[model samples]
Target: MIRLSRCAWPGERGAAAGVRRPKAAYNRGMSRNGRIIVAMSGGVDSSVAACLLKEQGYECIGVFLRVGAAPAAATDESGTQSCEVPAAADAGAAPRPRLRHGCCSATDAIDARAVAGRLGIRFYALNFEADFERIIDYFVDEYAAARTPNPCVMCNVHLKFGKLLRYADAMDAEFIATGHYARIRRDAAGNATLARARNLAKDQSYVLFGVQRSALPRCVFPLGEFEDKRHVRALAAGLGLRVHDKPDSQEICFVPDNDYKELLRRRRPEALRAGDIRDTSGRVVGRHEGVANFTIGQRRSLGIALGRPVYVTSLNVVSNTVTIGERDDLLAGGLVAQRVNWLTDPPARGCDVATDIKIRHMHTPAAGRIRRRDDEAVEVRFDEPQSAVTPGQAAVFYQGEDCLGGGWIQEAR
Candidate 1:
């Protein structure tokens, strides 16, 4: 289980800042829409979510997760926050790098607190550094194993939904909400289903596939109905919230500079040893600094003089070799995924179901057939051959906009 620590801001009298021990008499029945815990990242989307939930008569509590990123103070006058990029170390001093991001910074925590204050809601900053470090380790390990890792998906699965839900239960909140662009639809029978947001461009349903089926009913996504980010920003601006125009966080929060290789070098230098790069004919075409530096579909930076383009077709960590081949060599008719989490009822072994498969977050959903291999695995065969069926990435199964389930890709065939 993930453990958390709470930090109290100065001048807050009792408990952690904005946190109050629930009274024995206090109950969910006291609130109009019960109590909700909002994961506020000091971003405009989450700010708007808190505002909307408050407007809907729900008692809201805003939470900022501090995952070891350096916090910069929010500007006093404008109440705006920006990530503090660490300066290079002075001569003879050991360089200490800080995680830089507009989100997950101290400035972001203050911005969230300011919004919560404006909305007349309680706010708390939770320390998730330990849990986040595990994520960083996962990011590094996957690369070391010669596979691409989707840390965002892992974060959503384990931290945002998993640990945050555990916190909500402790707080006696009825729901846990986030600014993710996804929807939870309830049928007449009150069964919840996850779906893509109306704004397909901003849809985050793929990463959210790991949410436990039983927990779907209590998961709330307030920004799902917004047609676009502009509408959400406009709402925040109209409400006088300061983060209305804050740029969306694009890079992975921990790797703020987007230099994963640099992180790997610091965390696991052994993974960066020079290796041989070979082609399909088993001939050494070139040499590479590391197998971790290449992914299955990468075409650039090969440092080879091949007259035609060649893509990374495979990586053998044991042999310490990267295999490059023509684009057609990357195509695969099917893939096997393990650790499947089915949002709906698990399909019986040997049953085949038609669905759309998404291999990556930005990849378009493709027509496919999924067959249950066991309770925890499935074989997905695409109607048409797909390129770059990368292992260690998610293969989310969908039926239209509804997210049925997903799993981690194990291999391609």
Candidate 2:
């Protein structure tokens, strides 16, 4: 198949918003040309994805991923309507509570169910607590080792695309769609590859780089072509979706209230022991509660008045030392990335391929040379010295709108 429309072409990946009316092919309710499972989050985007697919003549099944839970108080004392869904079945336990935040609570499932009812489709909730635990562990372990972690990347790799696709197979569904603002397109050789969304502000391709290339064929992005999020909401409202105005979940599901420190203290106290904050010269200037409280390029909360402004340049967990220096010290000429996964055929080792390496979800992709180090590693040498290249963050490689693949940032020097 070429493409549904030339408007869905690649060159305008970051183009401006456009008015959209659902094509007539989707507005008919009698056709079921293909079967799909939309990963509904109870948010407007996923809700609209299901609605659009249903309207577009696809038989859609709505699935809500129970990725995390809310507070105990957010539910009831009897465990009935509890915020957290237990890992296994409990006859005496109370059902999940209706959560207000819509991360993984009963509230999200309820919203999805309502949409499924309106669209006349089947709805199901699947448990993945064990998989979610590994993601939490990875987050804590990365901070314990003085590195930043991207939990979303791990979740996409192991849960959404990996496990969810397996569930789709059990239901005999051909595809598992998501509300992610990214696209999947094929190359001249008919290989499936990832691409940035038309809505540049909401592009989620960065966190999704870890998704397996083999699983690309089974994935669908219903919201990828919409440069304007408001258009999706408009479509939802026209379809009578109640969540058309629902607020997007802005905080991490596990670390709600944005307090990673408290979560770390409860789960990994060893990383929070008292430590020394040292100047670049190796002289101790002040003492801090723990290394977990600091991150690369942090310029405040050191509790020391060093006369001149200083930034955190590095953290050595083994030595329990925090190195502070001038702003220039935070810049890195390059970094080495490990555990690389290629969505396309990877260039040979020692072959320096031109790319734009995006270090963070929000950072601009920097022009760089990705020298294939080995089968599982690549060295990224930036055209200019990049700042605060923290370990544990994803280094997503891209060429124009096409996502080459990505890996974890293991070393910055």
Candidate 3:
């Protein structure tokens, strides 16, 4: 299924349209008139991206990265698909209903291949199981250590752009393109820079700051200029692509139900071990089912009564206790971010700079003054106290619409 081309470039109006720019960065990851490997996920956005690139005269190769096998049959006490099953007991006698999560599933790969065929382009499913295993290990380990982890960032850094870039090099491709809602452009100095998408509502620049800056030039984002996701769906539909009507994938690909606590319990049982629920004063106010069940600033669902509402303020791994307190306790004045990855040039140590910080993906940006610390750290002092400055979550720095960089929250105080 493909639509009549829109001719993004002059003289290019169809999938088989002749290419005019031989050295365009969008097609220059290789020697000349370079080939592009579009990372298709069986979703409309990627499908549209591949469709547009092919029409624009690039030699497009559609590749769906195979990250995992089908999850085995299992159910929770409620007979719903649950991540609680232990790793060893997952393979059951009965088969489970297929999950339509919009990730790199086998079904998704097949759909990607079909799109490639419709476009008259080469297609392949690249095995990335080993890469996914490492990402999962890092995800579980971060939780086991009482820190919040952004698996998407790690996956982008290590695989989507890292291993995938290597694969492109081996294939003699000029660039790697994906459906990420971010923009890439060059600066006056001829260095590539990252920016938010034209559609601010769908901007995904936060999760992509870890990308190696050098590789940014070889990255192509075909949908960045579109102001609405509906436009993309319309374009794909106009082209007769089947995924044009597909719903957006909401849950984490690995955790289909978004019940991360269940995944943690299954993979890292220690995180679920019973632990004391203490007050800020070190009083044993209650007991909780391990630190994994709670996160900073979380209220409700916490089965405790102290004559007043209580919120999870902190997690002490050494003491094996979850500290609960009043809502005010969740307010943190500042934070320290570790393992910083600067998309732009980094400031000198102790150099003060003003930037907005986003603690979580959905959080509103908080105005803060940040200063470089060690080689891989930054200190964020917010203009005003911010609540629930969570650890393990990323602290992305932004200067207006530009994505400066970000790092993991090491401590929130």
Candidates ranked by TM-score, best first?
3, 2, 1
* TM-scores for all predictions: 0.84, 0.84, 0.85
lDDT of 2 by residue, 1-413 (tens): 11111121112432223546433312222223377878887778888787667756677888777765433423222222223332322211233443545266566666776666666776666656667999999999889889988888998899889888877776667788889989888555656789998889999999999999998867778788888888877665555456767778776788867789898999999899888999888999999888888888889888899799999999989889888999999999899999998988899888889999999999889999999875669899999999999988989999999899999999897
Q: Residue-wise lDDT of candidate 3 within 175-262, one digit each (tens)? A: 8999988888776665788888887888888889889888888888888777878777766555556666777888778876778888
Question: Rank by lDDT, descending?
Answer: 1, 2, 3
The better-scoring model by lDDT among 2 and 3 is 2
Clashes of each: 1, 8, 5
Q: Model 1, residue 373: displacement in angstroms?
A: 0.8
Query: In terms of lDDT, which candidate is strongest?
Result: 1
Tens-place lDDT per residue, model 1, 1-413, is 11111211122222123222211212244343588989998788888777667756677887888788445534212232323333312211222232357477766666776667667677777767778999999999999999899998888889889888888777777788899999888786778899998889999999999889998988888778767677676555555454766778888877867888899999989999898999999999899999998899999888787899999999999999999999999999999999888898777789899999999988989999999974568999999999999999999999988999899999998
Computed on alpha carbons, the lDDT of every model, listed in order, comes to 0.78, 0.77, 0.76
Pairs of residues clashing in candidate 3? 2-239, 3-239, 29-174, 30-174, 148-392
